[model samples]
Target chain A: MSALPEVEIRIGGIDVGVEHDALLASTPGAGACVLFTGAVRGEGGLGALEALELEHYPGMAEESIASVVAEARTRWSVGAVRVIHRVGRLLPGELIVLVGVASAHRAEAFAAAEFVMDYLKTRAPIWKKEIGSGAERWIECRERDADAAARWIGQHTPTGESA
Target chain B: MLKLRFFASIREKLGQGSLDVRAAPDVVDVASLVRHLDAGPMPGCAATLLADNSLVAINRQLASPSTSVEDGDEIAFYPPVTGG
Candidate 1:
């Protein structure tokens, strides 16, 4: 059985410099690497976003990501997984978060990377406060996120399985 | 007794980040502890976060309502995480 890979979790605004290094180092033994970065957009369907604040349940947040990475390890021949998320005020076009996975093949790497992201969106304890033109409000969980996570329920699937 | 910590928005809303509670032996469970804390001097924001949902962890493990708590254990409460 492949042992669990190194998992790093950092809470900060996204930095390409940091992310690139992590991705490069984690890719050494892996045949494929998948990196995903999520950015804050001007609009989130709520309205025009002026700024956004993200809050997280600190201890639980870290533990949850660790568990997700561990679970991915069990299901695939993964090499390393790094998850970094920024908390605090963010502006449009700014990077919000990143997930990088390394595995023996593109299939495992890509699937595990996407799986970690899907679970993180729904299961992790993070909240968003959107500052928009009308008023600032706590962002509600989207039904889309629930649906995204739901698709992974029982099957050993890949990205192509969904959109 | 256990040390309970709050972080991020929960900490900001509560006005303070950490607290200590003397846990009665019979009340050494997460649900009981949450009930006790809820009845304490937690601020409105902190209280609101727990009104319907809040994440709980016992010693760095995602804890359920039935999770056990013991002396010196660290219990934390906070809002849902949105981090990647």
Candidate 2:
């Protein structure tokens, strides 16, 4: 069987350079490599957000990401898909999630990366709890994200969708 | 026997992380299992796991309400994903 995409859910910092090197190394022949990282914004809800906590469904979380990466691969001419998501308490500016895709062409890489990100936003079994002074609320799924994911449904059927 | 799990706000609302549903002949599919769970031990469970509200996975793979369930299946219920 082919190798499944690299997916991780850990508590700590992610070395952006190290991940870039690994992705580039894996898909040396690819012409374009696109990497996207999501960081905790200091401002959300009300007041200065002190920290963000991510809760994931352990085994299901990894599996969901893999499923979407697999879907991305089927829809695009993709080479490598790497996803890293951090859990537990996180402060503002700390990187929370990273999605890296490598493809033979720039457009493919860009499209696949965005598709994976959009799918992940509305489907993966992960949640963000924003913590601010005397207030904490679980981040609700946004309408924009659901719409982003919806556009892909009819354009091309993403096979192996678990959810 | 079925292993059930909950995460994020669903877990918080359910007041627990996991629950075990005893195997029953009537609990044959995802829909039945969800009905059992909702009407059984943890009430309010059905509200979160409905087709439009939350996501459910059978054995670590995404599943719909009608997906079949077996004795050893691992099922999880959680809200719409908000990750990047």
Candidate 3:
């Protein structure tokens, strides 16, 4: 009753205008589209963050993101998934990344998009250095992110198998 | 000998991305190697990188501190992921 969705993955400075256009244009066959954007906060409470430098293992980062997208596709009857992560120097308030998922219904799209982000936050091999007033510090993985990923560990797959 | 590679913040702190060290006479594990590295001429940043938990990959696969290393193995050290 529904067609397979499209998926796009990129690593660059996310353009809100472009992303909005891409999602709107690509969702004609779908009724629901969900987008998640993560940005750098001015004050992380640790110190006054001047900027964040993101570094990623070139081929590995791409492969990791692609794997997350593939897993999402297998678990949900989703249409499309678009992920873009920016690398290099970024100031506070700048966009870090975006995850967009589209499906015929709201539930599938929303769940899949969240799943993609949760996986990316943990499994992806990307590092960030926070330049702040006191001193620059590399961010450590948060326990909350691990918890989010764990929630999907035992869920039944759309294909009748564990994802 | 094994080659240890560092990247991102770790590399920036150490001021060198890679190093070569002879394998220990007995079987040497990742923890020993890390201790040796930490005892090196580490600067403030280099010390800070190790202060918090770090991730290690032996030949590009996730490895624990007790992972073994043999001659010619490639090891990488990196900070916890912060990417989407």
Candidate 1's C-alpha runs over 4 A off are: A1-31, A157-163, B7-16, B38-50
Q: What TM-score would each prediction reach against the true structure?
A: 0.76, 0.86, 0.74
lDDT tens digits by residue: candidate 2, A3-63? 5348989997999887777777788577778999999999998579999989988877887
TM-score, predicted candidate 1 vs. hidden true structure: 0.76
- Residue-wise C-alpha lDDT for candidate 3, range A1-163, written one tens digit per residue: 2232232334457776666566656666677778899999898646788998888876567777888899988888876678888888889998888888777777887789899999999987888878888677777678998899999998875442222
Better of 1 and 3 by TM-score: 1
Q: Candidate 1: DockQ? A: 0.44
Model 3: clashing residue pairs?
Answer: A5-A79
lDDT by residue (tens digit), candidate 1, B1-84: 688888666666777878887877556688777666666644244354455667778887778777988888888876665554
Give the DockQ (C-alpha) for candidate 3.
0.57
How far is A124's C-alpha from truth in model 2 (Å)?
Answer: 0.9
- Here the TM-score of candidate 3's chain B is 0.76
lDDT for model 1 comes to 0.72
Residues B1-84, candidate 2, lDDT per residue (tens digit)? 799998888888878999887898889888888788778787867777674877788998888888999998899888878887
Give the candidate order by descending lDDT. 2, 3, 1
Name the better of 1 and 2 by DockQ.
2
Candidate 2 residue spans exceeding 4 A from truth: A1-5, A154-163, B38-40, B43-52
Sorted into a CAPRI-style docking class, model 2 comes out as medium
